[model samples]
Target: MLSVRAYVPADEARWDAVVAQSRNGTFLHRRAYMDYHSHRYVDASLMVEDDGEPVAVLPANREGDSVASHAGLTYGGLVASRGLRAEATLEAFERIGEHYRGEGIRRFVYKPVPHVFHAAAAEEDLYALHRLGASLVRRDLSSVLSPRERPAMNTMRRRAIARARAAGVAMRVGTDMAPFHALLASVLERHGAVPTHSTAELTLLRSHFPGQIVLHEAHRGDELLAGVVVYDFGHTVHTQYLAASAAGRACGALSLLLAELVGGVYAQRPHFSFGISTEDEGRVLNPGLVAQKESFGARAVVHDRYEWVL
Candidate 1:
C-alpha cells in the first residue's frame, strides 16, 4: 500500500537516504536546506511513501494561495528511486494534488528534474508528469565545460575580461556578510530590484554548505565592482545570485567575474550551469541576458516548469 504524508522531523535520516540515492537530488532535497528555507517560506515540503518506503519527495514553499514545489530552487521535481513506473508516479501526483487541495492551495507549480540527473528513469515514469495535468511553463539552459576544454578566455569574452583586468580589477572569494551584502544591495538597487535572501539566510547557507557556496567579488582596489554567489552542488556549479555596482560596470567587472568563475571554480565540476535565459532562436523575454550567456559559448539545454491548478 502507498501513503503520502507531510515531512516530519523524524524522517530526516530516511529523507536524506532517498536523496543520496537519486541523481536528480540536490542540497535543496536535504533536510537542512528545506528546514531553513521552509522556516522563512512556511510549510512547503511534501513526501510520498509506499509500504513505509519513501517513493517520492517534493520540496515546496507556500505563499498565499499558491504552493510551489521548490520555489527558490533552480532545478527541482519529484525524487523517486530507480524503476518507479508511470502508474506509481501518477499515483504520487494524485496524492500530492489532494494534499494541495486540502491545504487550500489554488495552484501547484512543479519544477522538473533535469535530464542529465535522471539517467536511470523509465520513459513511462518521465511521461507520467505530463499525464498528471502538468503543463509546461519556463525553461533554463545550462552550459558546461570539461576540465581539458577549460580555457582562460575566448575572443569576445577575453575582450570583456581584459577591459576589467586592465582597469586593475581584483576578485575576492569569501563568506563575510557585511561587504558582500552591501555590494549585492547596491546591484539590486541599480537593477530596480531587492535582494532575495536575507542576511541571516546567506549566513545559514554559507555556514551549512561551506565549500559549496562561494561569494565572488570583483573590486578595483577598495571599491566593490561586482559580486556573485555560486552554488557548488556535487557535480554541477550554479551561478545562483549575482550583482554589480555602477563603478564595476564602467570597467566590465561583471564579465570578468564570470570569466574567472567559469575557468576557476566551475572548471573542477563536470558541468557548469550558467542558469537560464529567456532568449531562444526566436526572440523571447529577457533576450539581452540570454545573449550575454551565449557569448560565453553556453548551449541551451531546455527544461520545463510544470503546473497544475488544484
Candidate 2:
C-alpha cells in the first residue's frame, strides 16, 4: 500500500535521506536549500511512503490555488529512490493527485530534474507526467559543455585567454562572496536588472552548503576583475552567476577564468553549465548572451516545467 503525507519539521532527516538516495536529486532539492526561502512560500512538500517505509519526497509549495514543485528553486520533481519501480512511481503520482484534490488543490506545477544531474538512470517521473497528461508550460535554454568529450574551444575564446594571460590575470577560489557580489551587482545594475540572490542570502546558502557552493574570481593582483559563482552538483558544475567589470572584459579576464574552470578546476566533471540564456518562459532568447556561451563550446539544454489538473 502507498500513502502520501504532508511534510513536517520532524521529517527533515527522512526527507534528506530519500533525497540523498534519489538518482535525480541535487543539493537544491534538500530541506536546507528549500527552507531557506521559507518566509516567501507556503510549503506543501510531501513524503510518500510504501508500507511505512519512505519511498520519495516532493519538495513543493502552495501558490494560490495550485501546488508548485518549489517556485523558489530552479527545479524540483519526485525525488524517487533508485530502486523504486516505474509502475509504483506512476501509481504514487495518482495518489498525490488524490491527496491534493482532497485538500482542494486543483492544479500541480512540476519542474523535473534534467537528465544531466541524474546519478544513475532516472526519469520515471517524465513518463508518469506524460501518463498524467501534464502539459509543458515553460522551458529555458541553458548552455552546457560536456568536458568528457573534450570539446574544442573556439578560436575567439583562445585569443581572449591569451590576452588575459598577457594581462597577468589569475583565477582564485575562495569562500568570500563580498567582492564577487559587488561586481555582480554593478554589472546587473547597468542592465537595469538585479541578482536573484542578495549578498546575505547567498552567504547564508554558502554557509549551509559550503562544499557545494564556491566563488571563483579572476583577479589582477589586488583588483577583482571578473567572477563566477559555481554550484557543484555531482556530475555538473553549474555557473549560477557570472559577471565581469569593464576592465575585466577589455583584458579578457573572464575568458581566462572560464578556461581555468573548464580545463583545471572542474575538469573531471562530465558537464559544465552556463545558466539559462532566455527569459519569459523561453519566449525571448538573448542573442549576445547565447553567442558568448556558445563561443566556449557550450550547447543548449532545456530546463522545463509541466502542469496538470489535480
Candidate 3:
C-alpha cells in the first residue's frame, strides 16, 4: 500500500536522489529550488511512499482557494518512480485534490510537461485529470536545434539569418548579470510587462548554475543592442530570457545574438531549445519574434498544460 504526506525536511537527500535518477527531471523539479521559491507562496509538496520508501513527489503552492504546481516553475507535474505506475500517479493526484480541498483550495493549476518527459508517466494520469473535470487552458510549442543535424528553418528565415550575419553585427557571451538585467528591464518596459525576477534572483541562478547561466550580448562599437540569458543543461541549452533595445531592431542585433548563441551551443551541447510562443492564428503569434528564432533553424514541438479543480 502507498501513502501520501507533506514533504519532510529529512527527505531532501532521498528526494534529490529520485529526481537525479529520473529522465524527466529538471532544475525546477528539485526540492531546493522549489523550497526557495515556494516561500513566497504556500508550500504544498506531496511525497508518496510505498512501505516507507519514497516513490513520487509533487511540489505545489497554495494561494487562497487555488493551488498551483510550483508557482514560479517553467514546467511542472508529478514526478514518480517506476514503482509508482500510472494508477499510482492518479492516486497521488487524487490525494492531492483531497488535501487541497480540505485546505480550502477549490482550483488547481498544474504546469504541463513536454511530450519528452510525459512519455514516462502512466497513461492513466491523462484519464484521471479528464475524469476529475480538469480543463486545458493553453498549448505551447517548443523549437529545438540539434548540433548533430542542420537547423530546421524555412528558406526565408534562413536568408534573414544570412543577411544579419553579412551586416557585420558583433555578438559576445559572458557571465555578467548587470548589463543583461538592464537590457532585460528595457525590453520588458517596451512590452509593458514588469520583470518577474529581481536582480537577486538572477544573481542566485548565476551563482547556483555557474557556466550554465550564460549571457549573450549583441553590440555595435560602444552601443549594446540585444541580449539573451540561456541555461546550459549539459545536453541542451534553454533560452530562459531575452531582451532587445530599439537599436537592436534597427541593426539586426537580435539575429546576430541568436547566431552566436546557436554556434556556441553547436560547439558544445547536443541540442538547443528556443522555449515557446503564444498561439495566435491571425498574426503568427508574435510573428517578428517567432521569425527571428525560427531563422536559427528551430522546429516546433507542441507543449500542453493540464489543470484540475477539486
Off by over 4 Å in 3: 116-124, 145-147, 152-170, 219-223, 267-271, 279-284
TM-scores, one per candidate: 0.83, 0.98, 0.83
Provide the lDDT at 220 for model 2.
94
TM match of model 2 to true structure = 0.98
lDDT of 1 by residue, 46-137 (tens): 77888888967777788998987777776567877664666877888788888888988889887776764443543443476677766776
Question: Which of candidates 2 and 3 is the stronger one according to lDDT?
Answer: 2
What lDDT is reached at residue 309 by model 2?
Answer: 85
| lDDT of each candidate versus the true structure | 0.73, 0.91, 0.70
For residues 181-238, could you state the per-residue lDDT of candidate 2 as single tens digits? 9889999999899999999999999999998999999999989999999999988899
Q: Which candidate order results from sorting by lDDT in descending order? A: 2, 1, 3
In model 3, what lDDT does residue 278 have?
Answer: 54
Q: Per-residue CA lDDT of candidate 3, range 71-104, in tens? A: 6787767776756666776777777788778878
